[model samples]
Target: MMEELEKLMEEAASLAGIYSQEWTNRNPSDPGMTILENLSALHLVQRESAAQVTEHARISLLKLAGFVPLEPENARLAVELAQKGPFSFPRHQKFYVNNVCFETEEEVRAMQGRLLGVYVKGQDEFREIKELKEGVPMNARPFGSEPLTGDEVYFLFDELPCGRKVGVQLYAEVKTSGTRNPFSEEEPVDFARMRWSCLTSCGYEDIVCQDETHGFLQSGKIILWIDTDRLVKEQVGARKGYMLCCRIVETAYDRAPELVAVHGPLFSLIQRDTQSFSMSFGGREDIRIQPVFPEENFFFVYVREQGCGDYIRYAEHAGPGSEEVQGRYYEKRLMEDGRLQICFLDRQRRYLPAEEENAVIVICCNREMMLHREMGVLGGWENQKFDLPPGGCADAKVLCIGVRYAKAEGSTCCTFFRPGTEKRDGVFYTYEEDSGQICIHDAGPYTGCNIFLSDYALSVWDAGNIRFGNVLTSAGGNAGVRVRNPVRGRKGRAKESFQDIRKRFLQDMMQPVLAVTEKDYKELALQTPGLCIRKVSAYFEEKRNQICVAVMAGTEAAFPRLPLLYRRQIERYLDKRKILTAKVSIKDPTYIRVDVYVTVSVIDREKWDIKKVRQEIAEELDDRRNEREIGQIISFDSLSGRIRACPGTGHILELKTIPAGVPGRFIRPGTDIPIPPDAACYPGDIVIREE
Candidate 1:
């Protein structure tokens, strides 16, 4: 601004010389020069004000370029209910930590039954299995080493929830080979392959309700809506109680499921609140309702005319014709103070009865809601501006700003264009998210025209990431029930800020929407929404015009394979982005199993714990397994150095890789293993010995 002011003074002096040279008393004490300086100072202040762009304006500019700020996400947590007997927990039951509220997503019935014994049928005999407790996970394969048709696993519970829905939680041992891809949309269970039944007085009866375990290919909860009124007491492996049996109707499993433990009555929790109210409006006027607790997370607002039996649709802009007002829709926007206001169509497009009509408003609280209000009447002037949050509405993020006005034909039109852009049959304006100001331009013909804030949304930012153990009390009136979150809340996010969105705008624009090259295919596969992908490799088969994309999951398990369901999702995601001539094939990379053996000499036998050293070496090898990529070369020459770096190791006496050099084999001990172009190496086994 100072630079511009100085430039202006120089230009003024040059102009004064062109007119006359007698008034060239350029001293600072001259009256004319003093007035010029004052005007320049005022000009500098105006320029400074113009240069400061507000947050709403920045976000609006980004939107003009097709970039939108993300909305706030609610956090989620898994809660445990500690109670006795069969207590039913209804969905949306509120739990809280002072002011922060968490609600249940599903109904869970607490079971009073205790798992007294576990049994597996073998050669026509029921054997007692004591491997259901902690520290005995790997040894407990509930369906035996090789599960076959007709094999049964029995769970004896001492008590039962009579005639109610019971929740059964299954914890699978981590040593299993299969992985659960959280992003996979394969939710339908293969009910034909498995059968879950309970022993009743009339014999076995089907009791399966909902099975989230996917036939035990992963760890999940199973819900059983059972009738325990006629449940029979069955004797299984020295225990006489009600038996819940899981039998294999058909042998179909990636790996026989191993059970670490089985418990019941698990529930899911989310950070949100829900409320509804009634409001009335008449004569086609604007309506404003201030919430009592404004700081709570507000997600959605639904308005319905009383006795209409349907919700009035929320539209972003007014329709081009007056008939659209009869579509039963309402617009929401933000006032100057940032509070949400609901607005209706103008008298030209819509008319209400003289008597007030009732409208029901349902509020879904996750910290965001629609807001609309009349900005003010516009005058035929240059740079007409209206401030949004003149006093209140602090820390509120405004999502979008739309305007509507009446045309010369007495019909209404709406637009989202900035000033000087081709008018889309409506008014033009710019908004600032930071200052909550809306500036109108090019309003010469529309003097006295009413400017309505047609659309906008507000959200609270980043205050929902509560810590574990923070939720301690139940807000709902369920006595004898205590809730605790075992894991910290996650996925809660604040709305994206103006500066943050700007930094990624160029990079996002540069990303290719169509998969035309190998790099494009790899990037698209890695960006498949909801999937945790560790690595991706794209290979183009020129002859067939097929791009084969191999994906690796972001998991630390012993073995990770791309499930058929996940592969289908990836294929569909890429299919929408590929060219007409290109064919996409989603596949899993081949794996090379490498076993390691080492013998080490310790400096002090008393100080060295060989078991701990071996465990550390195993962990290092696991890290290597996770970091390997397709066609990567594996070398054993660095094995000795890595083992020696472990504490309690003095020297490596012998080191060898499996299949490299056996008793009569010609292979060398520390040979570099060359992998195939489509294969990745994974750790198979590690055997450590002390010399």
Candidate 2:
């Protein structure tokens, strides 16, 4: 019999597996053998194997179907029922049983009789038989009627996951065995079973009712509502509460749609309440419910627990009030560390409030409902609004001034002179010519002049060091001066004459040299650094006026050999001082070949004429050429009368040609051409007349 039962059970199990696979294929989300199917299969197995299976085999068969056998108390009752058939118990008779299993009507009736241990005659023989069908109580009626059993009390709790919660409803049919005899009736007896064995076969922890008396009074059916929240809390602790709260906040942020539609208005509201409220969800609290915008999106939150004082905070935007207000604005700082700090205004300027005054400063950091006020306020409420800070916003107008340095190897370094300024010094210098570049000897007194440069403009000065005011006069005052002796002492009359000339030149340069004062250095350190300067080498070539200059240093060689990077740096430096053009050149790698000659013409065309300007430039070049004996001159004649002369004596003369009736115009020397009634010459062009 046992073997037969086993076979039947195995067959059922196989069918269940097949069904599960089919269900999974149809709906992947929910696929499994339901309790009803399992019970039906169990019933079929019992019926098919009953004749061949022994009692022990029968028990084993039931066990294989995931059912526990009736306990000894119930077993004895079952034996009696089997012997004398279904029986009814007297009023108030009760018994406790363990390891109870019920899959079908027969199994339920068998178990009921075994548990109650009473018998009745004829049709009234079956009294209060708690019908156990499919592991639940069903048809719990009066005595002599179908008894209420496990079949009727479906274990709905079994359907839930291990940790999930569910609600259960239990029904019981209570009936008195005999007619009521008023006072004569023997002490009102409680015929119902006071205690019940919690069946673990149904995938639940054994829950024995210690207060069985109450259970009986409430009828065998007792509804139990179980949820995982309490269980999780009991297992872990308060920490889970915080996590749960965060999850709740996230859920709110994710599903809240109205808040997202009005994000603009919400942001505006938040900005207006910049003081205590770091962020606002417009006038509605809908955003607070959305997890995406708040709990999940915003990294920080202000957490405040009831009873326990703990909070979290985060920083918000701090800037000017809409166009209407001109003062500086301040925002409260919300840092991750457990520190509660508040920012307020002192004399209209933003400042952090003392920690002692606000112990719940950390409360403003949490982005949870715990911090939200019932009035629909979000974010830190302790932070205050005020005028903007002294230094102003990052885009605020700023003045940057500093000295830059350039090395022979084309390396540069820079340093800041004060706050709110950039580094403009220490740039690498690459000499394009054998002769060294001239350094400013003097720049006169330093006025209240503050220098500022855009980021693009600063790139030029980064390669070299350009000094502004020195240690003493950097902050506020006149620039100081220092004179160094010539490289060599005065010698012969010629050398003495050279010495005098050099001394005079130096003196003249000294007039423009800006000096550093001690007070200026002290003030600069106290205030913010001046303009920021960086060191950058020419990494690539760039085109300017159709000429390619190596503006960057890299393997990808492009542009002409001129050290355009250095020239650009110098041009930027001079432009800062409102100086336009300067002479620039590039020396070959070996310093033996002249790569290119460059002249930076910084002319505000509105103030200068090109043709007349060229003539003036020619006169200056001629003077310099006459001073040098080794200069060579090569002249070109064209209709425009533009002359290009390279004096073999180390000088280049560029002359602009004036139009005339003849194709080739005569060029003249030492002649100052007056500006024509209608000046048509462009700057940087050379003009020459017949000589």
Best by lDDT: 1
Which candidate number maximizes TM-score? 1
Q: Write the per-residue lDDT of candidate 2 for residues 169-253, one digit (tens) a residue.
A: 2332232112111111212222233222222323333322322112222222343333422332211111111001000101101
TM-score of each: 0.50, 0.14
State the lDDT of candidate 1 residue by residue for 1-691, as single tens digits.
Answer: 6788889988887787778778878877889888888888898888888999888898899999988987557677665544445655554556666766666656555535556667877787778777775245445777766677887888777777655544454322223342333434532323127788989888889876576566665555566767777788987656789888888887644355666666543457666653212233443445654433334524232344333332333443444654346543555666774345765543454332233343433233222332334467777676788865332222222223333455555545443334334464445665544565766766644567665432332322356676755445664335325666644446676657877798879788778788999889988888775444677888887777788887876544455677665576678788888987888888777765657787888887777877776665554444225555565555565556667666677978777665322232433566665555556555667788787
Task: State each candidate's clash count.
Answer: 20, 153
Q: Candidate 1's C-alpha lDDT?
A: 0.59
